[model samples]
Target: MRQHEAVINVMEEHGGYATLGFLNQEVLKVKDCVWKTKTPFASIRRIVQDERFFFKIKPGLWALKSYKEKLPTDILPTKEISKSQKEEFNHTYYQGLLVEIGNLKKFQTFVPNQDKNRLYLGKKLSDITTISDIYKFSYDHIVRMTQTIDVTWFNERNMLASLFEIEHSTPMYNSLLKFIELQDFYTDFRIVADDARKKEFQSKLSLEAFKPIIKRVGFWSYNAVAELHSKTSELISIESKLRL
Candidate 1:
């Protein structure tokens, strides 16, 4: 690719926030795109203007911003969410929360389950632009919990209680499974290699295996997710805590 295209690709990868220094280094390293021949800084600006590749946050720093193709406006709630709606909502919301934490941790370090949508934090973490973008993405995901769980179905006044009862085990397991799937681990492999093992595991399991896992997972995951939200509530928080 040409210098401009190369820079655009990097910005695309890093959510439109590639530094000039980093771009210069990577482009120079590429054998085809000779450092002496191509004007990287100019190409970066050109791509930003032409392809809407990205814009400046500080002086020379640029990040990816995919604001064009909007996410779906209509939110889908869970099925049969009325009577046990609080439990369901808590599950979904905390799932998102765990996801956000996982995403941040992945950004900071290597996480095994980086691909799963723990709580719809992919959109929030990917291609961040301004501080407002960070807030908006987080806010959007948090609100989506209500849409999925149907807060009105469970509690008239105590929203917290309604959100606090969702079992976390299933969602956490789901998140881990999602990560494995992203890594191209086949489900059929589980059926072949671990099917009998799973059956035996299930058979040997106690009733607590089901309810206790969910309850503890729910509680812990909620703490994990809620902490992330609280930590990243402001731009200062984003900069200081999230390192965004």
Candidate 2:
């Protein structure tokens, strides 16, 4: 109890909110501490659950409270996230990756006439309600509607380099329709989603109508997108160093 108290005091002194690993390290550093045989993290968890000093924001993530401070009533596990909240989180997360991919494409000089205009977000079908309206629209409007890919990387001549659609619990049918409508030879089409949705994606793509383009489409999980984002930074750093 004394040892756990000492750790809590240290945490409070440090302004609270630290990982269990960090607290365990601190406890191990104590000189000839009592209850050394027992695991510090287990003891700390018991103390927190008993006294309620903090809330687990996520696995290995926590938000601590001071003595007499009230615990927040709203903290919930990721699995408990509301439907709309989960959708928003997934949208924002995938949008960030799209932005990253767009920015990275801007740095590519190998592609002739590469410019900022090459990247675009596909217009939602809500912009145009009917197929009849497509006839009255100008060439640019038709192109944008036809190529309504979620994220696109094209060249100065408007040739597509890559395409991506973030399907966060939404039907893949619409995204696939847009991809097929604007199918370009030599362009890469990728569908990004949660890891658990790979089977769902395959089932959707296996439909007879989508057979022609199914072979060209690729699946990218959220974790894969995050990893790509991380590597993009490393590539940019290396490029900067090379230019120096």
Candidate 3:
């Protein structure tokens, strides 16, 4: 079997579409296809760009061209759906990526209660999150505020390590102001949104009110977040084999 053929087979088994991280993890297991290169992951990345056989669904996500029409509605929302519904799916998809990435990095993950029921791929966000309640590492008021964050990663000490807010179509101000509330903490903040909105994010972060966190906060485009997620999994897989 060919390399791209193996990737296609794996994607087909996954119902037509799969994340770059998923392909990197599963494509290597195909016994018939021998990946002789030192950078098989890179090869997979290049293969997905063939375009003749696959199509990109989103950042870090691709689907077999043959099965595009058969993918789940959530994976490829149609024009018949409301704009809000499409936005909702995109938001949760990134949240799911963050949750999985945090878990792989040995951090406890969380999402707001209202998002707990949203589907990330086929699984519920609540089902995949590591914690049901935010750690009461601070005052009641502070903890309550943290619970409403889009996605949060808590370190082993139960301290906030990072907070990510997906700004698909929402204002960056809301997420930035929310981050401001937790500015005292030694945590990193990111506004995850489209590359087109990067200027908007920077402009919002420049406001006098956000100056306190200007150094601690950064803008992450959707593609960047997706790339981090896919690469993180690759590194973990390497670590497993390199452990002494």
| lDDT measured at residue 33 in model 3 versus the true structure, 0 to 100 | 98
> Per-residue lDDT for 1-244 in model 2, tens only?
4766666665665445443434544544455456654344566556655445666543332446562243222223155667876565445445445555456556211111211222111222222111111122235754655444455565445456667788887888888876776565567778988888899999989998788798899999876775565455445544654774
Q: Model 3: per-residue lDDT, tens digit, 66-148? A: 98778788899988989999999999999999999999899999999999999888889999999988899899998998888
| lDDT for each residue of candidate 1 in 1-244, tens digit (9 for 90 to 100) | 6766666666565444544434544444455554353344455445655535555433234455563233221112334345454343334443443333333333211111222222222343122211111111124544343333211111122122112223322333333232222222111111101122343333322244344232222223333334344343322333543455
Candidate 1 TM-score versus the reference: 0.24
RMSD of each: 19.6, 12.6, 1.3
Off by over 4 Å in 2: 1-82, 107-142, 146-148
Global Cα lDDT for candidate 1: 0.34
- The segments of candidate 3 whose C-alpha lies over 4 angstroms from its true place after superposition are none
Per-structure clash totals for the candidates = 11, 0, 0
Best by lDDT: 3
Model 1 misplacement above 4 A:
31-51, 67-244
Ranking of all candidate structures by their lDDT, best first = 3, 2, 1
- Ranking of predictions according to TM-score: 3, 2, 1
